[model samples]
Target: MPADKKPNSRTAMQPDDASRILVTAIEVGDIETIVALYEPDAILFSKSGRAMQGAEAIRQDNLGLIALKPTFTIDFITATVSADGQLATNRMKADLAWTDKEGKEKRGSVDTLEVLRRQADGSWRYVIDDPYGSMRANLERR
Candidate 1:
């Protein structure tokens, strides 16, 4: 689907649905869809150890990722919704494939933690996304 194409409005998005949609958007290099999945004040903990806040910053960071033409799969380990159903958290394991700046294809795995908030319209959007959430612990164990 084109980046400009909005998600289907008929189904209300759950935390898992939001994650799946994000994976699809990234695979298709759909920057618009990716940004739409986040709340206006969302924050992303980038791999470079910087926090990217708001839609514009997130968009700028993702542009670099999208330029890599990455292909990836997200295996959600867990999703827990708050009692009020307005907030949720998810743990995921992802396998990614992309071409590096050196013009070589690379594959890697990552652990991610994501926080989502329910929108007024019943859709869920990401409030915080940390792609390297588990990297430090994993590296320490090795």
Candidate 2:
């Protein structure tokens, strides 16, 4: 069965719920949804090692990614919540597929790490999103 290309309507108010929302947002090519999942001062580390800080910068970066029309599936590997339950970390393996500029289908796998914080409204938002963390670690092993 093919995956749905729409963001889940359910609100991501919990840490465990954020990953699914992230994947769905990307799959649906919704840049606003992607930005809303992050903290206002969050930082995103791109695959090319570019650091995008704050929601505006992250939104701009996500706009470029949305232009690619990428579809994503994330498999949660592990999650650790802080004692206070205000901070959490989620590690996931992601499969991504997209059509290239030449209309050729491209696919790849990545391991992602997200640090999320509980907001005043009790919603979970990522403070740091590093989608290429595993790739960077692998390269460092060489």
In candidate 2 the C-alpha lDDT for residue 11 amounts to 53
User: Which pairs of residues collide in model 1?
Assistant: none
**True lDDT of residue 22, candidate 1:** 71
Assess every candidate by TM-score. 0.84, 0.87
Which candidate gets the maximum lDDT versus the true structure? 2
Model 1 clash number: 0
lDDT of 1: 0.79
How far off is residue 39 in model 2, in Å? 1.0
Cα lDDT of model 2 by residue, 1-142, tens digit: 1334567653567776788887777667767778889888999998876888999999888788778777776665577889999999988897889899999999987787789998888888999988877677775666
| Clashing residue pair totals per candidate (backbone < 3 A) | 0, 0
The parts of candidate 1 lying over 4 Å away from their true place are 1-12, 137-142
Give the best candidate by TM-score: 2
Error of 1 at 138 (Å): 4.9
lDDT tens per residue, model 1, 13-101: 77877667776667677788888888899999877567989999989988888787777776665789999999999888889898998
